[model samples]
Target: MTQTENSQFRIECDSMGEKQIPSNVYYGIQTLRAIENFQISGLKPLETYVDACIYIKKATAIVNGELDCITPETSKAIVEAADEILAGQLRDQFVVDVYQAGAGTSHHMNVNEVLANRALEILGDEKGNYKRVNPNDHVNYGQSTNDVIPTAIRIGGLLALSRTLHPALDNAIAVLETKADEFQNIIKSGRTHLQDAVPVRLGESFRAWAQILSEHQNRIYVASGDLMVLGLGGSAAGTGMNTHPKYRDRVVEVISELINCPLQPAPHLMAAMQSMAPFVNVSGSLRNLAQDLVKISHDLRLMDSGPKTGLKEIQLPPVQPGSSIMPGKYNPVMAEMTSMVCFQVMGYDSAIALAAQAGQLELNVMMPLIAYNLIHSIEILGNTVAALTDKCIQGITANQERCLEYAEGSLALVTALNNHIGYLNAAAVAKESLATGKSLRQIVLEKELMTEAQLAEVLNLEQMSAIRPLGS
Candidate 1:
C-alpha cells in the first residue's frame, strides 16, 4: 500500500479501538489507570462498592421521575436497569480498579455507565447514545457524586450486614446456646489468675459466650440503623442546588422501597458529606465485636487446649495438618484464623478512624480509604464468624471425663462441703485426700464423719450441679 493508504488504515484501526469503548467511565477508567500506573496504594474495590452502585442507580431513577426530567417510559426503563444491576447483572461490566482516592467518583460513574448501558438495551438503542437517555443528564439528573457515593456506601454496609454478618452471628449464638444446654450438668473449676478459685458449672461459661454475642448483635443493628439515613438529595454541597424541590424525598422513598427498608434523608447534608464519622462509628462497633470474638476464640482454645496435658474440656474439629515436623499433632487452626481476622478488623477500624479525621470543611476527600477499610472489615468479620461457627463451634463435643477429673481435683468444691461441716474440717478432708491420692468418697468413708447413706445424700452429683444461691 502507498503511504497515504497505510496512514488511513492506521487511523481506521485507532478509531475502531476507541469507538468500541464507552466514554461514560472516563473518570473511572482514568482513576483506575493512573492508580495502576502509579502503584501507590495496595487497596482494591470491595463487594460493598457493587451495592453502593446499585443504590445510586435506584436513587437517580427516583429523582429523575420526580423532576420529570425524563419521559415516564425512560424513567421506568431506568428503574428496571437499576434493579438488574442491584441483582448483580452488571458486575462484570464494571472493570475499574477500587483503589482510587477521589471520594468514589469513579464508583459513581461506574454505576451510571452500567445503568445507562442497561437502559439503552431496554430501548433497543446502542450504549453511548446519550441523546436518547444520558447517564449523567437523564439518569443522574438531580444528584451529585458527593451525595450519591456516600448514600451508596451506607446502603452497601447495610447489605453486607443483612446478607452475611447478621446470619453468621445468629449461627454463632445458636452454637453457644446448644453448648450451654449440653454442658448444663458438667461441673468445672472456675479459675482466677490461672488458679482454681471456685466451683461452677461448665454451662455457665458457655452462657456467658452466648450473652456477649447476643449483645453485639444488638449493637450491629443500631449502627446499621444510623447508616440507613442517607445523603442522596443533598446534591453537590447540601444546598439542593440544581435538584428539583421534590427530588430528595422522592428519591429516598424509592430507595427505601427498593431496598425493603426505611431510609430517611440526612438532616445535615453538609456534615454528612464533610465527615465520615458514621463510618467510623460503624467500624468501631464492628471492631468491638471483633475483640469479643477474639476473647471467645481464645477461651475456646484454652478450654480445649490438650487431650492429655491440658484442660481438654472440649474438642475442636480438625481442619488440616497442624504441623510439618511434629507427627500426630493437631493445632487450633480455626481459633488462630479467628484471632487474625479480629486483628485485621482492629487495623481496619484504625484506618477508618484516621480517614474520618481527614475530612475537612465541605467534603471528605479520603472516602476511598474509608470505604475500602470499612468494607474490608465487614467482609473479614463475616467470613470469620461463618468459619468459626461451622468449622469450630458446631462439631465441638464436651470431654466429659476430663471435665470430671478437673472438677474432682479442685479443692474449691470443699466450700460446698464446708456448709454442712466446719470449714476447717472440710479443708482437712481435702488435704488428706490430695496427700493420699484418694477419692473424696474414700477419705470421707475412712474418716467416718457420717453414715454411708448420709454421705451419698450430701455428695450427690445432682445436688452438686445445682447452682448455689448467691451468698451461700
Candidate 2:
C-alpha cells in the first residue's frame, strides 16, 4: 500500500485488510481502525506514557542496529523519528482511544506505525511505504504488545512519579513541617468522637500530617521498586521468540541509560510477563496515600470550620467564595479540591486492582486499563498535593486567642485533676461545673478538691498541650 501524489489519503494494507488513512497523519491503518472501533472515554494516552513507548522504540532500534538485526540506515532513521517524538513532535499522531483493544495491541501498533512512517519520511520515502521502513520488521523488530505494554507501564509509572508525584510529596512534607514549627506554641482542644477529649498543641497536628505524608512517600517508593525489573524481550508469549540472544540484557541496559533510570531484566521473564502484581502494588500504595490525604484534608476543614460558630483554631486561605448566594463567605476550596482528587485516585486504584486480576495465562488483556489508571492516579495525586501545599497548607494561620479559649474551656481538662483529687471527685467537680455553668477551676475550688497551688500545677495548659516531636 502506498500514497499517490496530490492525494488527501493513503491506502495502507494489513493482514486483515486495508484502510485509507489521512495523508497528513503518521498513524496508519490499525490506528485508524482503533479510532473507529472504540469511542469510549475520548481520552488520549498520557504524555509520559507516550514517551515511555517512544523510549522503548528508540532503545530497541539502537540495539537491533548494533546486533545487525536491522540495517544501520534503517535504524538511524527510526532513531531520528523517535527522537523527534521524544522532543515533543508528532504527539497528535497517537490518536488511539485509551479504551481500545485488549493487551494494548492497537496502541502498540499505533506507536510502531507513527515511528515507521516518520522514519520513512526521514529516509526520503513517502508515508505507507512499508518496504522502505516496515513498522513490524524494523521499528518493533524484537517486541510484542505482551512485552512492550507492560514495560511501558512500568516506565511510565516511574516517569510520572519522578516528574510529578514524588516532588510534590517532598514539597508538601516541607510545607507542613514549616507550619508545624510556626504553630508549635499554640494550644487547642482535641476531639474524640466529635466530643472534646484533651488538649493538644496546634503545631502537633501539622507535624502529624507531615509524618503521614512522609511515611506514604516511603511506602510508594518501596512499592515502585518492582517497576525497575523488566519483562521486555519476552516477545510473543514470553518464549523470547525471534529475539536475539543478547537482546534482553542489552536492551534493558540501553533503556536505563536512555531514560536515566536504573533498570534490569527479570530473572524469569515469563513470571514478570504473567504477573500484574507490580502495578497492583503501586496502585494500592497510591490508594493508601489517598486515604490519608482525605483524613488530612478533613482535619484542615474542621480546624478552619467557622469564625463565629465552629472551631476557629486555624484559618485556611480563602481562595474563593463559598456559596453562589452568600455574599461574604470564603471556602477552603484548595483542601476541598484535594479531597476530590484523592477520592478519584482511590477509585482508579480499585479499577487497577480489578484489571490486574483479570489477566489470564501469559498476558493481561487488561494492561491498557491498568496503565491508564495507575499513571493517572500518580499524576493527579501529585498535582493535587502540589496545589494543596502552595495554596492552602502554606497560607494557613493559627488563631492564638481562639486556640487558648478552647484549651481553657474544655471540660476534658478535669482529667488532669484525677491524680490530685481522685477520679470520683474530679468527675463530681466536672458534673457540678456543667450543671451550674461554673468553670472547672471554680467548681473544684468550691468543692475543696485541691488547693489553688495544686490545681495550678496540675492544670498548666502549656504542659497539658506540649508539642511533641514527629514520630515521638
Candidate 3:
C-alpha cells in the first residue's frame, strides 16, 4: 500500500479515461475508482467472499471453454489466475470496500480486472493488454454484476457457516454438554420472577443451552439449503439473454465440482435476481441464535454477579481484571463479550430483514450492505462463541453449598406440603416462614403440620428437581 506512484506505472483505460495503475498490483482502473469512491468502513470484504468470487471466475472459465466461447488456452490462463486467488494469493487485489455499489458492481469488476491482468501476464503480454485478455470482453463473458454477486454472497455465506461458524458452535455445545453432566448432582433454588420458587438441578440449565445451539444449527442448515440454487446464467436482468441454453447447468456443474457442494440453477432466474429471501431466512436463524445467546449470557452474568451478595449460584471464570481501583476484583468479561456480540448480530439481522424487503423491480441494490452485515455477523458470532466456550463456559464452577443454602431457606419449599397437608395449612406455613425469617422446615414443624418422617418422605428434594415432578 505504500508503493510510490511513478511514470512507469501501466496506463489502463475504460469508458472514463486512462489512469496509471501501480505496476505491482493486479487490480485495474475500475478497482481504483471503487477504492477512492467508497472508503466507508476502511475494512475490506471477508476472505470467504473473495474466495466465492474466485469460484465464480473459475467456473465461468470452465463453462466458456466447454461452450467454445473462449479458447481453451484463454480458459486455462483465467482458471490458473483464479486458482491463485482461491489459494489466498493476491488477496490485496480485492481492494473495493464492502459498502460499495449496492449491486457489488465494483467488486465484480475488481475480480474481473485482477483475473484479466493475471491472465494477460500468463499469456506473456504486458499489463493493460486488454486486446489479449480484456477484463470484460473475455474474462466476464456471459455474466453480469447482478447475478454474479448474489450467487457469490450465497456461496460465501454458506461456506462461512459450514467451514467456520458451525465448528465453533460444536465446541461450545460440547463444553455445555460436559458441564451439564458435571453439574447434574448440584441442586439449586430456581427463580421465577426473580423470586425463589422451587428446587431445580443446575445441570438442566446447561443442557437447555446445549439443546438451543443444536436446534439452531439444524435451522441454519435448512435455511442454507436455499443457497444451493443460484441465478448464474441470468445475465444482466435474469432474462438469460445471450447465454447458451445449457450454460446455466454447466456453470453450476463446474462450480459444484470446484466447491465440492451440490448446486443447481435457480428455478426462476428473474425472481432469484430480485428476491433475497434465502439470505433473510439464513439471517432469521442467526437472529434466533443471537437472541438465545443474549438471554443465556445475561443469565450467566446475573448468576455470577457477586461472590458476596448477588445470585451466587455460579461463578464465571475471571478472564480479566474488573476495575482499575478495586483489588481482588474480576468480571465476567467472556459473558459480557458474548452479550455484546449477540446484540450486534441482532442488529445485523434487522438490517438484513430491511434489505431483503428493499428489493424492487428486476434486482435488489442493497446486496453490498447485506453481504457485509450477514457475513460479518456470522464470523463475529463464531469467534465470540468460541471465546465464551473456552474462557467462560468451560471454566465456570458451581457454588454448590451456596445453592443448597438458598434452597434450604426458601419459603417456597412449603409447596411440597400441599399434597400431605391441606392447602390452607401449607399457605400458613409459607407465611409463617416468611414472617419469622425461619426455614420452611422449622415453620412446618413448629406448626405441627406433619411429623419429620412424613415431611422427609413427602418433601423429597431430589424428586422436586427430577425430570418429572412428583404428582404432576
Candidate 4:
C-alpha cells in the first residue's frame, strides 16, 4: 500500500500485522521485522549466497512461466529483476542479518520481497502493490523456505568452489610445484620430533606440500558431487505440495542450464531437505585443508625463524615491517595470516557440524548459521590461500649455505656408517664426536671405522638426500 500520512514510508501488511516499510527499499515487512529482531550479527549474507538465491528465483520463474503457474508478464518481470540483481544491482536490499529466522525464512522472504517489489516496479506498479505482483503468491509460486534455503546452500557451495576455492588451490599448487623444481638440489637437515634425524632435499618438502594441496583439491571436488542433488522441488515440506507435476524436473533443468552446472533433483526430496550431510561433508573437507595449511604455515615460520640466531634456512619475502620497536626486522606475516584464516575456517567447520546435526523432525532451524559459516569459510580460506601463494610461496628464496651447513653438521650423518662399522661402533663414534666437538667423518676416520673412501661414499650428503621419485 502507498503511504497515507507520510511520503517517505509505505505500509506493508502481513498475516501478523502491518509495518511501515521505507519506501525507498526493495525488501518488505518480514525483512524489516528480521532486521529489528536479529540485530545479533551485523554481518550480511555472503554475495555467493545471494547469487544462489537469485539464480533459484530465476529458474523457478522460467519454469513457472512455461507451466503457466504464474502469468508470463509476471514471470518475465521477476526474471528481469533477478538478472538485474545478478548483474550487481540491488544488493543492498538484502539487509537481514546472518542470524535471522529459522530455516532462513526471513532471508528467503527478503529475496522474494525484493524481487516482487522490483517486478512490480517493472510492470508500472508501486513497490507494496501485492495485488499486482505478490511476494508469496507470484514470486514464490511453488516453493517454501525449507526447500529453498538448503538448495541455495548447495548452489552457493558449488559456486564458491568453482569461483573461489578451486582457483586458489590451483594457484597454490602451481607455486609449490615450481618451488619444488627450483629448490630440487638444496639439501637440509630433516628433523623428527624437533631433533635432527636425517638429510632431505628441500625440494622434496615443497613437492610433498604440493601433493597435499592437490589431494585436498581432489577431495573437495569429490565432496561437491553431493551438492548437485538438490531438494528444490520439495516445496513446503518435501511432499511436492502445490507444485505443477512437471515442475520438478523442468526447474532443475533450467537451473542446470542457468548455472552451467549439471544439477539433478533429489531422489527423495524429504531426505534431501531434512539432512544437512552434503554441507557437512564439504565443510569437513575444508577443515582438512585448513589443518594442513596450519602445519605448512608453522613449518615456514620455523624455517624462516631468524636471520642470525635460529635455523634461517630460508627467507620469506618481507611484505611489511614485522615489529615497530625493532627496525630492519621482518616476520613471516603471510604465513601467520594464513594460519589465522585457517583457524577461523576450522571454527566455522565446527559450527557447521553442530548446525548440521541440530536439525529436527522436519526442518533445521540452524540453516542460517550453516549457510553463513560454510560459504564464508570457503571464501576466506580461498582468499587466504591465494594471498599465501602470491606473497610467501612464490617469493621464497633458499639459503644454500645455511642448509648445507646444517646438513653437514648434523650428528645423524653417522646413520650411514651403521652398515660399515656396525650399530654399536657407529653409536660409539657419534658419542665421541659429540663429546670432543669433532665431525662425524673426523671421529670415524680417527677410530679407523672404515677406509676414507668407504666413509666418504657412505656419508655422501647428496646420495643421502636423494629423493626417490614418487610411486617408485
Candidate 5:
C-alpha cells in the first residue's frame, strides 16, 4: 500500500474514549495511546520479549480451548495469529517505547491488540473489527498486564542468555585459553600499584581473566534458572478471581511444553508479582561480567600503551586509524569500545537494581524500564564479549623480547638476593639499580652482592615467576 493509503484510518474506542487508528495496521487504540504517551525513549521493546509475550498468549489460548473456555474456532484463529508472531512476522506491530508505565499495561495491551486484529484477519475479517475478535475479552483472556509483563520478561531473558550470552562467554573462554597457551613462555614484569613488582608469565594473566569470566557465566546460569519460577496465573491483584482455578498450572504446562523450558507458577502470586529480585540477581551477574570485562580491557590498554615509552608488552590488532591527525597512529579501539560498553552495562545494572527495589504493595510499576535495561545489557555485553574475543584477544601478539628485557632490567629482581645478600643489602642493590640506570643483575654484580652464576640461578625468569622462588 502507498503511504497515502496507509494514512487512511478506522475508529476504535476504549473506556477513556475513541481514537482513529491506522487503517492498515494490526495494533489498535490502546497501543496508539502508548505511542503518544511514552515517547521518552526512542527504543522499542526487545523482539525476544515481545515474542515471549506472544508465546504466553498462545499457550493461554490453547489451554483455554482444552478447558472449553473459548470455542475451537476462536482458539484456532488466536493460535494461528500467535504462530505468525512466533515465526517472526509483524514484529513491527509492537510500538510502545521501552520506557512506559510502571505496570507495563500499555505494552500488554499492545500485544493483545495486535494479536486480536491479526486473528480476525486469519478468520476472514478486516482490521479494527474488535466485535468479532476483542482484544481484552478474547486475546487477553484470563491474563493481566501485571502477571504477563514480568513473566514474559523472565522468559525472554532466559532465552537470550541461553542462546546469546552463554555462547559468547564460552567463545571468550576458549579464545583466552588459546592465548594463554600461546604466551606461556613469554615472561613479563608484573606490576603492583603501577610499579614493577616481580616476574609473571604473560599467559598466566590471560588464564586468570578467563577463569573470572567462567565464574560469571555460572552465576548467570543460576540466575536464569531462578527466572523459570514465574507468576503467569496471577491476574490483576493475584487473588485468582477472574481466572479459572486450574488455569495457572495447565497454562504453565502448556508454556513449558511450547518453549521447552521447565516453567513453574510462583508459590505466592502476590509476592512474585511485587518482587523483581530475580531479575535484579540476573542483572547483578551481568554487572559482574561488565566488571571483569572492564578490568581485561584496562589491562590490554595498559600493556599496549606505547611502542616506545609505555609497557608495550602486547599489541592489539589495529582495527582502524586511531587519530585523525597523528600520522600512521593506531589505537586499542576494541579495548576502548569494550570499556565504554562495560560502563554502560554497569549503569543499566544500577537502573535495574533501583527498579527492582521500587516495587510497592502488589506489583512493580517500573517493569518496562527494568525490561529495557536487562535485555539491552545482556545483548550489548554478549556482542562485545564476542567481538573482544574474535577481534582482539584471539589476535593479540606478545612482545616477547620487550617483556624479557623489562623483566631482566626491573629493580624488583633484587628480591631474588634477599637470602644471599640480606634484606638491607638487597634494598641497597635495588636503590643502586634505579639510581645508576643499570639492570638489577649488573648492579648486584658490580656491588659484589652475588656471583654471576648465583645471579643467573636466583633471577631465572621462570624461577621468579613461580609462586615461591628460591633466593639462595
Candidate 6:
C-alpha cells in the first residue's frame, strides 16, 4: 500500500481496535491521550472513584430496566458486569489517566468503557461491539457526565467515611481513652499562657483530646449525611429532560440497595446542581477536624518536648533517629507527620472552598476539582489519625518523675492551701518557703499556722488535683 493509504488504514484499524475500550463510546485514543498528556494532580483514582463507578453501573441498570430502555436480561447482564468491576476484577481495563480538566469526562468514559466491555462479555459478545450492548446507549442510557460525576463523588465520599474515616477516628478515640484511664492519677502542672496555672491530672488532658475527637466524629457523620443526599436524576441540567420520571427514584433505590447505604434524591434539582453547599459543609468539617489534629499534635509535641530541658511530661515513640549530628537525639516524627497532614487537609479545605465559590448558575463545572480535594482530605485525615493513634498515642508513656518534680515545684499548689489559711498568710508562707529553700509544709510548720495533721487535712493531694472547686 502507498504511505497515505497505509496511514489511513492504520488510523481506521486503531479507531476500531480490540483495545480496552468498548466500541460504542465516542471517546477514543484522542480523549485518553489528551488526559494522559496533561498530568496534573498527583492523586490517582481513589476508592471513591471505584465506588462511584460501581454505583453508576448499578443505578443505570435499574433505571434502564424500569424505563423499559432495556429488558431484565440486559439489566442483569449489565449489573453482573458492573459487579465484576466493582469486585476489582477488571481494573486494568480502566485506562484513563488521573488528571483531566473537563469535569471528569475522562473518568466517566473510563467507567463507561469498562462496564460496556464487561456487559458484552456477559452477553457472549466480543469487546468493542455495539451489537448486544452499547456503552453510551445501553450503559449510560439516561445520564450525563454532570449528574454521574457528582453522584459518584457523593458515593465515594460516603464510602470513605464508612470504610476509612470512621474506623480511624474510632481508633484514635480508643487510644485516648486508654491513656486517660492509665494517667488518671498522675498529676501535672497545667499551663494556660505557656506558664504554670494550676494542677491537673494527666488523664484530664487526655480526656479533653478524646472529647474533641468525638465531636469531630459527629461532625463527619453530619457532613457525610449531606453527601448521601445525591443528585441522581438531574440529567444534563437538573431537569431530568430525557430520563423517565420513574428512572429517577428507581435508580436511587437501586443505588441505595447496591451500596447498602441510604441514598436520597435532592428536593430541588436545580439547587442541587448549582449549589455545592454539601461539599462546602463537608470540607468545613474536615477543616475543623484538621484544626483539632493540629492542636493535638502541638500538645503532644510540647508534652514530649525535651529529653534534657523542656516539659518532658510524656515520651513519644521514636520511630527513627531524629538528628544527624546528635547521636542520641530522638524526635516526635509521628507527631510531626500528623501536623503535616493537618496542613495538607487545611489546603484541601481551601481548594474546596475556592471551587465552591467558582460554581455558576446551572451546574458547577468544578465538580472534578471538588471531588479531588475532598477525597485527598479524607484519605490524609484517615491515614494520619490511624498513625497518630497506633504509633504515637498508644505508645505514649508519661514521664512520672518529671511530672512529679514539676508538680512539686509549682506554686499553683498553694491555691489548695489558700482556702484554709488566709490568702495573705498563704502568700507569705510561699514566699518564705522559696527564700529559705524549705517546703511549703515546713514553712507553715515553722510559722505555727496549724498543726501538721490540720495542714495535711487541708492540703491533701486530692484537693490540689481537683478539676473544679470543692462544691462550686
- Best candidate according to TM-score: 4
Candidate 2: clashing pairs of residues: none
Q: Relative to the true structure, how large is the alpha-carbon lDDT of every model?
A: 0.75, 0.92, 0.88, 0.94, 0.88, 0.78
lDDT of 3 by residue, 135-244 (tens): 88888999999999999988898788877789999999999999999999998888899898888889998998999999988898898899999999999999998787
lDDT of 1 by residue, 1-472 (tens): 0123333211101211322233333222333344445455544466566776676676667667757767777888888887776676656665555566467776566667667667877988755555676767777777788888788778878878877898998988988899889888887777878776565678878888999999998998888788888887788988888887887788888778777888898888787787787898899889999999999989889988986888988888888988999888889899999999999899989988887887667788778777777777887798899998899888888887778777767766666667667788888988887788787677777888666787788766557767767999
Per-prediction tally of clashes: 1, 0, 0, 0, 1, 0
TM-score of each: 0.84, 0.98, 0.96, 0.98, 0.95, 0.88
**TM-score for candidate 2:** 0.98
RMSD of 2: 1.4
TM-score of 4: 0.98
Question: How much is 242 displaced in model 6, in angstroms?
Answer: 1.1
Q: For model 1, what is the C-alpha lDDT against the true structure? A: 0.75
State residue 112's C-alpha deviation in candidate 4, in Å.
0.3
RMSD to the true structure for each prediction, in A, is 4.9, 1.4, 2.5, 1.0, 3.0, 4.0
Residue 400 lDDT (model 6): 80
15 Cα displacement, candidate 2 (Å): 0.6
lDDT per residue for candidate 2 within 264-317, as digits (tens), equals: 999989888889999999999999999999999999999899878889889999
How well does candidate 3 match the true structure in TM-score terms? 0.96
Better of 1 and 3 by lDDT: 3
Candidate 6's residue-wise lDDT over 1-472, tens digit each? 0123333211212343422323434344434554556577555567667667677778788679877988787788888887776777766555555567556777786677667667777888755555577667777888888888888888888877777888999989988999999999998888888876567899989989999999999988887888888787888898997888788888888888878997888898777778888988998999999998999999999999988878999999888899999899999999999989999889888888888888777878887778878877888899889988888899999998788778877766676677778899888887877788788888888888879998788666656776774778
For candidate 6, the per-residue lDDT at 324 reads: 96
Range of the 10 consecutive residues with the lowest summed lDDT in candidate 2: 1-10
Query: In candidate 3, how many Å is residue 346 off?
Result: 1.0
